[model samples]
Target chain A: MAEDCILETSGLVKEFRGFVAVNDVNLKVRRGHIHALIGPNGAGKTTCFNLLTKFLEPTRGQIRFNGIDITREAPQKIARRGIVRSFQISAVFPHLTVLENVRIALQRKLGTSFHFWKSDRGLNQLNDRAMELLTAVDLAGYADMVTVEMPYGRKRALEIATTLALDPELMLLDEPTQGMGHEDVHRVMELIKQVSANRTILMVEHNMKVVAGISDTLTVLARGSVLAEGPYAEVAANPLVIEAYMGTEASGLASIPANDDRPPGPLPGEGDDHGSLRSNSGGAG
Target chain B: MSRRVTIAYLLGLALLLAAPMFIYPILVMKVLCFALFACAFNLLLGYTGLLSFGHAVFLGGAAYVTGHALKVWELPTLVGLLAGTVAAAALGWVIGSLAIRRQGIYFAMVTLALAQMVYFLFLQAPFTGGEDGLQGVPRGTLFGLDLSVDINLYYLVLAIFAGSFWLIQRTIHSPFGQILKAIRENEPRAISLGYDVAKYKLLAFVLSAGLAGLAGATKTVVFKFATLTDAHWHTSGEVVLMTLLGGMGTVFGPVVGATVIVTLQNELADKVGSLVTVIMGAIFVICVLAFRRGIVGESLALYRRMIGQKAG
Candidate 1:
């Protein structure tokens, strides 16, 4: 069980000035599992993602990737070590063609990223693989389209395709479906599941339905610390997790079912927008 | 390359080859020098998204180096030019290492401040001839062809411009160029994709400085002098104006921008005198207000729109 952990963070901590954004998080992600880190706003989920990817260095902790200490590694080195992250906002190169965006990732492996004098005609060989990745995300039809001109949800799909181009062992997705219609969310969720085969995904997701639908394990964070960790059903039913998510006033954990696609009751601090969610899902269906 | 673009390039080349017969060769050589300078500047400002406020340091610094080598050192023309380019590249490495540590306006400020320091150093340096400028730089022979003749020098400058232009074009389309555009579009995303963003930016800075240095070195050989005007902050500002007026990121934008600005400066310098500055300023204002994409970018956008409408 100990050896099964592909990424393990022991006593991870991050501080901005005097304020501790992520406080002492000890996380262990098993190999080849779709792990979801779900939390409300300001739960330091994004900060944790930043820490893992080395965008923000940990104030105190040891990040071990396959038992090697990576806490001090640079962000690009971490990426080169096969841990790639997607931005909260769709991260495609806006002016580049969709195909070109994916090709940029594929080009990294060609060992000629510094050969400025060579013609890019050599990169044409990468087009087939770029198209394959694009097709995987159902973006083959829009290969020639400038990414800025792409539909919002499709841009997210392209982000996934670009991330896939690196063939990362651990893919960190930050709000993969943050701003999406129900149909798009459902599609992205399906796409995430499809791409998660034989690879580990550590995603920071806010949408409960998407989290519940695909994730193999759940890590609930609140106030920058782990509140609960287990299977979805178990974590969703944990009293501390429920209290943290809904405040003390909410009862009956069954209201937020593990398998239900319909919008759940409004969690604490989020305004009552359940009606809009239901209507969006209904209209999309 | 597209057939249309290739045809345009060829026709432009032919026009330049025949230009010396009709126009003053010296004036054409001036245009070519500036055109190359602007193109090199665009590689950083346009493709890499780095706005260098101190690029005049490279241009002026190289001019002084070339002038000294030719006049004082009595070095061959090619060797002098090489020395100038290498010096600029070394300076670029030093400045770029520091400037890339900051980003955006901070990056610009760092480059600007460093350039000012170099400018002051050049002012006090004994070899530069100070206020008098480095005078009477020899053209010398290049591969047994005496470059003292205007036609011979013009052809050499043309060859240098064409070769450097081809190199820039190749870089823009290379694998490295793809990454550069990615960095320009979204830097953090590029970093997260496992790129050393700072390293790429520095390399780009060095390459741009080297090419700009080449242009300045060539300019010194053509005019037979290197002056404080070459390194002035105004020259830096002028290159920016040329890039912006021609088009920031387009392949041919800087060339067109340089020609227009240099031609206006020359034609108006004798007639309107210093008012040429005011006219250039007015043109800049109009360019920014009306065509923010500059001439080439706007034309391309318009052409694309027309083609899209027809296809649709």
Candidate 2:
């Protein structure tokens, strides 16, 4: 592992009932860089992201974050270690106001989470900072609005703003721009760019435009393994990467490519591996 | 605060103060106890998204402990209540630690199973008096004031209920309450935000259990008995009905639910006799089918819709 790498994984594997969803994968993300993991639908990108975030335990391999071996750490522990994540579904407290959502994130730093008897007024101290974070995300105008009422693009923005309130060293975002329109995609890309200035980012995104536009480093996964890794321009042009993208439509559903069993494709497997991968990929990635 | 909520609370306070004059003090006390019990249960079900089907154990179990201490050990009234509250909290910690290992219906099942175990233990245990329960427990004086009189006990019950209600309100609005709501709204999201979801859940459970015990202890004092009725699974079901009927997530929902249900039981049990259960079942079905959000939730939604239309 390089000294500058903020996150490193070696031989990471996730298996369910003898079916390996993510095979032996070695992923290293440099500090202070936006690293995008891009792959075909069944490439195990989401699985890889879950493993890194400690949401799913790896069957084998070690994950190191900031020089700490975090393979056995819990998801919340990993989050507290400065690696916060945003869900693909725009994880905001639907009943809470946008400011309350951000304030909940900021409250962890205050170390009064267990102080149940204290008046919530003590949390008033954090309002200015929470507001600042919302303002940074262009959500200050909607501070008092309950998050469920916010527009989809704005919800994603709120998710990012909440994640940013943690002041994390690394942020893991799964499909930050999934299900977005042309304009939403553009706004999120710019927001990611802005937030990436101070912290490292590891994201699994399906949008090729987003991958190409802002990713400083790209790792291509197919069949739960890293098919290629390099800068966006280099990896995007690779024949193996081209082969992976060709069989699959740019619309993101081009079968599993499981039969090819070669470069940029899933290895030949027993029948019915494709059954849940679609749902898993959609939900996880 | 919304104008509606403030007015409702004021109305509630007035009703509470004037209730003993019109209604039987003991009946009002019973309602207050159940109301507190429902509110405590709501902290988990409404705000934390946990459904515990065995909460009656906490309330009933505390009643037994307080009755035992006050009657046998001859402890002071306040001391006996504290003992009951502590006992309930400890039980809650144990049960919550185990129950929180599961989620949704599974969590409810775990709590229900544990409560059944508690029921059997009390049934077979010597101190509980088995089928007869701890009977004719004394209602001691508070400080220097004698609490044996109906009026005095009413005030005491009112004060305790108000304090518990205010505490619940404080908790819901407090930072810890915010986290509970967040966990209820979305667990994985709260976890990713660096919250130990299990810990928050366990704490909420303990708090709920402790408060439930307070209600039970108070009930024991008013009724002068801790019986099988307190610990029965039927009691657990009744509290769930109260919360759902009032409004699962609303601030005043549980109290309203308790009032409506207790009134229904008090009035109908006399005329309809055993058919009260059938009527309650019908009410539950109607609440679930028509106003799924319960009375308070539906009213709030309606008010919001009206206000939003006017503003727009």
Candidate 3:
């Protein structure tokens, strides 16, 4: 019950048919911190994120944003409540330009108006703000470009700026650095860090190194349940994690050193717990 | 706006305004009515990415309603117009609710099925006069003056066309219109964004249908008849063809498309009465393949790109 906890999910559960995708998950995201959720895979990280954002309703649970119950609110309503996300896939309007895409998001944030009789270009505040977000993401140079023509990576970056246009108090990044080369990953990581300076950030990432490099606190999920949760150092050295990691990837992966420079240990449980849950389901289902 | 576009719009407006003097006023009125019809249809197909084969329901339904009001009840022109618009909106509400149940091509089938039902209703309804329809209806004065003359009727039609066009333009630029676009682009995402996507879509459909009724209302008086042709599935097809030819989402695209189809029908009606159908089909194909954005959409896209490059 931290005074400044920005987000909290209590007993969150999402079940499909007879199987549970996310099971009785309890988590907290503090203010001005980059909280990373990581697991090997199928750790229910995505399902948890979906429930938190109200993109998917939980079968049973409570999602509170700054002490407000938002468990069953619509995604846009939740987004308007100051939580916004960038999807794993680029979700921009292909027909509109990069600037227009950002502008649409800005327009949504502004109150609805019946008077569109006048020119739409006079909203200098929105344009200036969108331009700022584009610059922050290092995409100011491509503002005028039609979204469809932009390269894949730039499109992804623009998606982040679009989400930013909603003026989120808590930003949800679903694999922000995914599908990138090392250099691009580094640049995005820098952008995320800069953004996290003001707003709270919660991310579900597969990259263990990036997770460790950014997260202030971490939660590890396995089979829709918490396997471990805490600061990066303590969880990395846990023996249960090593055992879990080794049994995954069909290759029984290499050992993560107990004292390795493994980028600060993204969240406590990291990928080990996620690997175990999905693999076990393969036999059960 | 680019100088060419500004000049072209002005020139087109001038030509349309002077149409009654050069062309038979009745022919000019026909073009304007159909143009408005095409623009109304575009609200759904182009702006909302909905292909409604049921739009003839609005056009024809309005005609029948206006026909009854003007001929049977002898109501004034305003009353007839209101009757048509209200009937269209009612039909739009029911059909939009049902048609929106499916998406993509399936939605098209649903609307087409619904429209066929409406066509049958019009065929059997007592007010429709079956095959004969309502004939020799008066154009009526604005309030008390007789607009029975060709010049007065032409001006009336032109004013309706201009008002409907301006209203539609305003609708597209509104917040609600933006939500519809969001639905068109990605329904699931729009749903996730918290807007009741279906409600927004339904409203657009109803409004489009109602405005289309206004066009149909004026058309009945312009031709001095209300007939089965107004409700024909061919009418639906023709409207769709015009929208596709003009580009789905552009403001003036439907107007230009309507004018082209109307002019084509006039000139080509002599050599081959039905050959205009073939020509319209060909134009639709050419527009779809070569200029998928339509004349206005492509031009706007180009303008946007050019400005984007300049900004860049």
Candidate 4:
């Protein structure tokens, strides 16, 4: 069972000054599974992602990847160890062409990323592979286009393509479909599903459809701790998870599919609770 | 390179070769030295997105080292230049290691503070000759060519400048350069892609510093002296102004910027005296206000727009 888990965290805690952002999270992501980490606005999903990637040091805890402790490793070292993460915001190099963005990721494998004396013409060798990755994300036509001029949804797709170029054993995606139209969201979900073959993906997602449609396993967090962990269907029906998502009086667990596209409306006596959730997410941004 | 750009470069080189015939060779040499220095500064500022406020440390520090080697150690000109370049690169490594820990304005402050320390060390150091400056340094022979002659020395400076310029161009377009652009565009993204961002930044700082040192050493050979003015904060500020005036990121922008500023100072010194400072300041203000993309950057943008319209 231990060998089956690709990434595991035990007693992982993160605090900002005196305030605890993540408190004693114990997580296990099984190998080759599409694991989704989902919660309400202030549930510390982003903070957990930061700790897993070592962008923020945990106040107390241990993180293991393939049975080796990686709690103290640098972000780049973790990435080199096959944990590549995408950003909540689109992370493409704005001035570079779409092809160049993917090529940069592939260039690391050539071991010439530090060779300043050599002509970049050698990097032309990477163009075919870069184009292949772009083609995977349906960005082959936009290869020559500067990334900043790309539409918002296309930029997210580019980010995914760039991430895929790394060919990581485990890919962590933060809010991959945060802001998108229905068409783009569906396209990206399909892209994610297509790319998940033979690779493990751990994603922090807000869209319930994206979470419910693709995730093989789900972990629900509330107030920096795991409230429920199971299949999406099972976690959705957990009474405590329902209360954490709505209030105690809420009986709308079955309507989760319908309410997934929009924020759940303010239930009676839950007005202040909903308002605070909105404000917390806004402030985090 | 584009056909248009290659042609422009060839034409520019021809003009430079013919320049000494009409303009004073020493003045043109001075411009070349400063132009190279500005270009080195631009590598860190424009391409890598590091605004080093203490670049004059490398420039002036190398000048002093080259001058000392030639006058006191009696080393060959090439050796003296190499020694100076290596010293400045070492300094850059130290400074960059510390400065890259911070970002934006804080990074600038760290470089500035360290440069001030080096300035004071040079000011009081016995080898630098203090306020008297390192004077009467010989232009030692290179390949048995007597560089004492201005024309011989001018050609040497031009060769050095052209080589360094080519190196910078190659670096800006190399695999390393692509990483640098990626780092500049999005540092965190670069890191998440498994790049040790600090290492790249430090390497860039060292390269930029070494090139600046080469420029300084060449200037010392041309003028036969090294002065306190080279290491001063004002000189550091001047390089920033030159880079901004010409175009911060574009190739050839700093060269044009350095030429204009150096020529203006040379031309105005006799007529305006200290008011040249005020006039330069005014030009800087106007540049920041109206020509933020700078002379070369703006022209390139306009050219692209015209080409785009034609294609459309």
Best by DockQ: 4
User: Candidate 1, DockQ to 2 decimals?
Assistant: 0.78
So what's the TM-score on candidate 2?
0.93
Clashes of each: 0, 0, 7, 0
What's the residue-level lDDT of A97 in candidate 3? 75
For model 1, how does the per-residue alpha-carbon lDDT over A179-282 read when each residue is reduced to its tens digit?
78776776798888888898899998876666766788999787789988988889877888766656422233324557534343334433333411111112
Give lDDT per model, in order.
Answer: 0.89, 0.87, 0.78, 0.90
Query: How do all the candidates rank in terms of DockQ, highest first?
Result: 4, 1, 2, 3
What CAPRI-style quality would you assign to candidate 3?
Answer: acceptable
Candidate 1, after superposition: displacement of residue A114 in Å? Answer: 0.4
Candidate 4 wrong stretches, greater than 4 Å: A1-3, A247-253, A256-285
Off by over 4 Å in 2: A1-3, A247-285, B1-7
What fraction of the true Cα-Cα contacts (under 8 Å, chains A to B) does candidate 1 also have? 0.86
Q: What's the alpha carbon RMSD for model 2? A: 6.0
Q: What share of the true interface contacts does each candidate keep?
A: 0.86, 0.81, 0.27, 0.94
lDDT tens digits by residue: candidate 2, B145-216? 888898999998998898898888878877899899999999999999889999999999999999999999
Model 1 regions more than 4 Å off: A1-3, A247-254, A259-285
The residue pairs found clashing in candidate 4 are none
lDDT at residue B209 of model 4 (Cα atoms): 95
Model 3 agreement with the true structure over B81-198: per-residue lDDT tens digits: 8999999999999999998878999988998899998898888988898888888887777766577888888888888887787778767767666666767776655654445667
In model 2, the Cα lDDT at residue A69 comes to: 99
Clashing residue pairs found in predicted model 1: none
